[model samples]
Target: MIKEANTTFPIHPLIKSRWSPRVFADTPVSDEAIYTLFEAARWAASSMNEQPWRFIYAKRESDAYKIILKHLAEFNQQWVKNAPVIILTAYKEKFNSGKENFHALHDLGLAMGNLSLQAQSMGLAVHHMAGLDWKKLQEIFNVQEGFHITTAVAVGYYGGDPSVLPEDLEESERAPRKRLPLNTLACEGKWIEQ
Candidate 1:
């Protein structure tokens, strides 16, 4: 079963099960699920419909897996390498609007959000890492200079074994974290001071 079935997102019940964990079993991910996840991300909203997000991934048994794994921060590398897939999420700098803006990063974020939710629906876990080594990933994937990586996503079946994950990560994997109160995160009514 997935965690926090009642997610804040408007996603369906199945998708809400998706959660992130550093430790994943060596089990492989099916090609069908990978295709479907990207397909869902393809339909995510983008600035001016630019759809700037792009994904590059390596399956667990592939040689590219090692290269991608090396790009992860030491903290993440400790466990993410055990997963079945290592994915680099990126975005093209240029948009359909003929402008070079930072909106692509935001667009990429939305795409990842869609992917995470979709993976959960399929009984999968996607551990995303923003603290990875961007410079190494760019070189490892042979990405062009203009385009840049946004995050690294580790996808696989959750293996709740405490031995595989660091003590801190293991604690998180065991239970759901609390969210900030709506009153703290959400703003209400007029912007003017009372």
Candidate 2:
């Protein structure tokens, strides 16, 4: 089930092997593994050492898990139910100096990147979703001001019956992975519209 990226240039094996899956096995991710993933995120580079990222996670069997599922958009709820773990991501909107931290979300993304790669290394699958009711989550969690909810993530071991998904999603699950060419993404010292 390894959907390794077909890259033009060689890349790290973990990066190549990582792909988000809508289906996840029923196996429970170990607490140790979860801690390890966060440990990796904890070391990611942040602006001015203001590691603004915050996470609220729940195991599938927990009541909190149900609450999170309820807040997700209908489409995400369809597939995320099978995940062993659900995580809510957020970032502080302001620095300790009371100034806006424009890079808060960017730093949060770096942290999630670290977590995702760590999950891949551990033989787990991670899928990030932006389709959720963030305002509800904020209210539910009583997240104080200056912190903004960003996204939700599903984590678990891979291998589930794609056939169980709706026809369209099943097709998407089985589709070949594709990416834009590097030339279109990066150029020398100038912006080029492709």
Candidate 3:
């Protein structure tokens, strides 16, 4: 069920093909593939090489998976429950020198981008979700003082019945992918309101 993006300009096939899907097959992603995804993330460029991104991942049926699922917003839990893998992402608030790293979130985004592309290349789907209890996760995991929980992700092989989703979600699942035009997104030398 590949919903390849209908791009106005040519782009990398992987970029064009990647889209977050709520529906995921029950097939489990292999351990090696999971590690490979992280390996791709590990190489993402970071601010001052701080590499603040940190991830805690769990396969379906694991105790950690249940704990994560329990914290997700009800809406997310409804769909995410079918995913074979779940991951929590966090970033360090400060560098080793105790200085604030304001770009930590941006760096974490870069890492996630790398991971998503890798997953796409391997015929896997990645869905990032912000609807979670991050503060609770921080306490539950006993994360270090400077580390802040950011987002959660669902990963698994694509191909699940959209009919299983709620009416609104099922419509969304089957709808054509859409994005803002490039002109609205990028501007030349200066900022111009579209």
Question: How high is the CA lDDT of each candidate model?
Answer: 0.79, 0.92, 0.94
- Which 10 successive residues of model 1 have the least lDDT summed? 1-10
- Which pairs of residues clash in candidate 2, taking residues 3 or more apart in a chain or in different chains? none
Q: Could you give candidate 2's per-residue lDDT for residues 63-114 as a string of tens digits? A: 9999999999999999999899999999999999999999999999999999
* Model 1 lDDT, full chain set: 0.79
Off by over 4 Å in 3: none
The true-versus-predicted C-alpha distance at residue 109 of model 2, in Å, is 0.5
Better of 1 and 2 by TM-score: 2
| Model 3 per-residue lDDT tens digits across residues 53-138 | 99999999799999999999999999999899998999999988999998999999999999999999998999999999999988
**Full candidate order by lDDT, most accurate first:** 3, 2, 1
In order of appearance, the predictions have TM-scores of 0.86, 0.97, 0.97
- lDDT tens per residue, model 1, 1-194: 34654546576665555567776666789899899999989988998888888889889888888888877788888888778888888889986565796788888888888888788777678888897888887886789877888888889876646566678877777776566654565577745333
The true-structure Cα RMSD of candidate 1 reads 2.8
Q: In candidate 3, which residue pairs get closer than 3 Å at backbone N, Cα or C atoms, i.e. clash?
A: none
